[model samples]
Every structure is written in C-alpha cells, then in structure tokens.
Target chain A: MTKERKPKPVFIEGAISAEFIGNSIAKHQSKTTIGAHDIFLGQVRADQIEGKTVKAIEYTAYEDMANSKFHDIREATFKKFNLTCMHIYHSLGTVKAGEICLFVFVSSPRRVDVFNAIEYLVNTIKEQVPIFGKEIFEDQSHQWKVNS
Target chain B: MTLKIKYFGMLAEITQCEEETLSFSKGTAADLLKVLFEKHPILEEKEFQIAQNQTFISNDSIISNAEIVLLPPFAGG
Candidate 1:
C-alpha cells in the first residue's frame, strides 16, 4: 500500500487588513514546544523626499509567479532553519503611505534560530518575490520602490 | 515560434506595454533581450533582470522557444 500527500496551498492573500494576519498566526499555532515568537511588520513611511509629500502606494504582483516563489521560500526556510511555524503576508492593491505593506512572523522551539530565520525569510522575500509598489507623491507623481 | 513575453517595472515603460508576443526562435533569453533592446534602445542601461517562469535566468542563459517572461528588479517588501 502507498499513501500520497498533497502539499498545502501556500497561504497567500492580497488584502488591506491586519486582522487577517492575526488570525493566520493564531491558526498556525499548535500544542508544540514553541518557546519563542518573532514578528516583523513593515509599515509605509510618510516621508519628505525631494520636496514631495507621499500619498498612497499601489502594489502589483505577478500573481502566479509570486505564489510559486512564496512556496519555494517557505520550503527553503523550513529546510534551512528549525522552526515550529511561520507565516508571511503582504498587501497588494493600494496602501496609503502610512499603511503596512508586509508582515512576517516566525515561531520556533528556541530563540536562536527564530531570529536568524526571520531575517533570512524577510531578506529572501524582498530579493526574490515578483512584487512592485509605486509610491504616489502628493503632487500625483509616482516612483517605483527599489530594494537597496 | 512566437514567444509571449511579459515585462515589468522600468522594462515595461521601455516596452510601452505590459506584455507582447514576439517571434523568436529557440535561443537564450538574452538573445531576445538583445533584439528587444535593438528595437527599443532605451532599455540599454535600465538595470533589470530575467526569469523563465519560476526560475531566474542569467543574462547569457538560453531561452527555450516556448513562452518566456521577463522581469525587472524586484521591489517587494
């Protein structure tokens, strides 16, 4: 006899909500030896750049590609680090300049790997994900976000 | 064969459209890019990258005759 297992769909949702993220984290937890939890929330900054006031941000993504890349990132993180659970959420569509664009939460049995894993997952997501955000200035001018 | 190519970021600006179909034979993605650059000279120094489906491709890598997608620098946070 043989058994087959289907991979869980990579939890990807593009919405402008924080409650959804909180719920995701709640569901990911189980009765395991989880000792540490670390989270990184990226908020949109209202800043003055070149004499322009920032307005809202428009986010776009290659949906199919982004989903697949996220799956790979999740798998790689699990393989490279010891973690109890992890969740990554990013907003799409329009987000105001003072809104959040991304959130990453990682939990592990110990604290050491959680920190490194969080950093790695976040860095990789920024470097590899096929997502773009346009920073709309108050004057209606626009600029693309560049990862530096 | 015709390769359905998609563009993003500044590359989309240079192409003047989000996507287009190009007639290209089985060759490296760089070749198609070179041809694209020839037609659109503004893409010469745009600082971009490429990906065939889900896999990242180097500048000199060969692209299959099948449909391929081109991507620019990522900005996902």
Candidate 2:
C-alpha cells in the first residue's frame, strides 16, 4: 500500500497582511457563479494584563504536525459541507500587537456555506493545530497565549 | 528506539527543557505518553495535544514507535 503524503503548513514568520491573504482568496475563486465569500481576520491587541503590557506575539509550531492537521481539517470540511474553496493562513515568528495573526477565507456558490465554513475552519484550527503563540510584554516579560 | 519529545508554553516551563529524546519500544503514541507523564507528573495535571510526525493525533490515535511531537494548548490568532 502506498503511504499518503501529509500536507504542509503555510508558515509565515512575522505578520499576516490583508493583501497577502486576499491574493490567496482570489486565486480560489472561479468564474462559475461563485456568489459568496466569508473571511475572518484575527488581530493581536496590545492589552495590559495584571501589570504587563503585551507588545507583540511570537508564534511557533511543530511544522510537520501543523501541516498534517491542516490537511485533515481541509478534507474533513470538504466532506462535511459543500464548498467551492477554502484558505487558512496563520502567522509565525513575531507579530506585533494589533497585527493580524490568523486569516481564514472561504468561498462558495451561496452565502450560507461560506458562513458555516469560516466558523468551522477557525474553530478547528484553534482546537486542533499544534501552533503556539507567546505574548511578549513591553517590559520584556512573556506569557503563552491560550484561547479561552 | 529513541524518540524526541517536545514541550511548549507553560508545559515547557514546568518541564524546564524544550526537547528531549527517550527510549521506547515500538509502541503506540498513547503508550509513550503514559511513560512520559509518569516520569513528569506535572504533565498529568495539564491538558495537552500530541502530533506524530508533525500531524495532530487524538489521544487514541494509533501511533507506531516513531518520532512524535508533544504540544500544550496553543494560543494563536
């Protein structure tokens, strides 16, 4: 039996920009009556927790694991729902506060699938991927970020 | 065979190291974790995730005694 190849995680060190993600979304759109597109952009916020001001975010991942998870999620999503195309992009390395960290784009023939697909993609990424983010404070103190 | 195990975030702090390789038989992923957690008791209290050959696996995922990556709860956008 042939072994299946695992998918690769799209890793970008530093920041995620709207233009970069927008271009990726554009490529998936087809001329065939594609009517709806839904997008979710996760931006880092400069927040003071306790006594520290979060200055930036540093993201890292088990690349091999993250990519594999992405592929599985992609396949499962396609099977569970009908969709035209989906794209997921997340930031690696250092991302300053107020910069985007995660961008998810989905397009479909109708509006309904796009909404559901975006939510599913975002949630699955949060719940499944092995990517981690470290919150760097202005004072140089750091903490790991976890989705609540 | 020996496999590398990695720690992240708070788990890394608790473990006091980022990565280490330990010996194991050709066992499933769960078996490796059982031994690791026993040696590092803090892991038992914390919730974490596992990735075998860079792919995320459920706790019950059938993993051979190959290299695996361990991760804690991640916080990313």
The reply for model 2, stretches above 4 Å from the true place, is: A1-9, A25-32, B24-45, B50-64
Model 1, C-alpha of A62: deviation from truth (Å): 2.2
Candidate 2 residue-wise lDDT at A89? 81
Give the lowest summed-lDDT range of ten residues in model 2 chain A. Answer: A1-10
Clash pairs (backbone) in predicted model 1: B28-B62, B28-B63, B29-B63
i-RMS for every candidate: 1.2, 1.5
User: DockQ for all models, in order?
Assistant: 0.73, 0.61
> Can you write out model 2's per-residue Cα lDDT over A31-98, one digit (the tens) per residue?
47678888999999898999789999888887766777788888787777777777778888999988
True contacts kept of 2: 0.71
Report how far residue B5 has shifted in candidate 2, in Å. Answer: 2.1
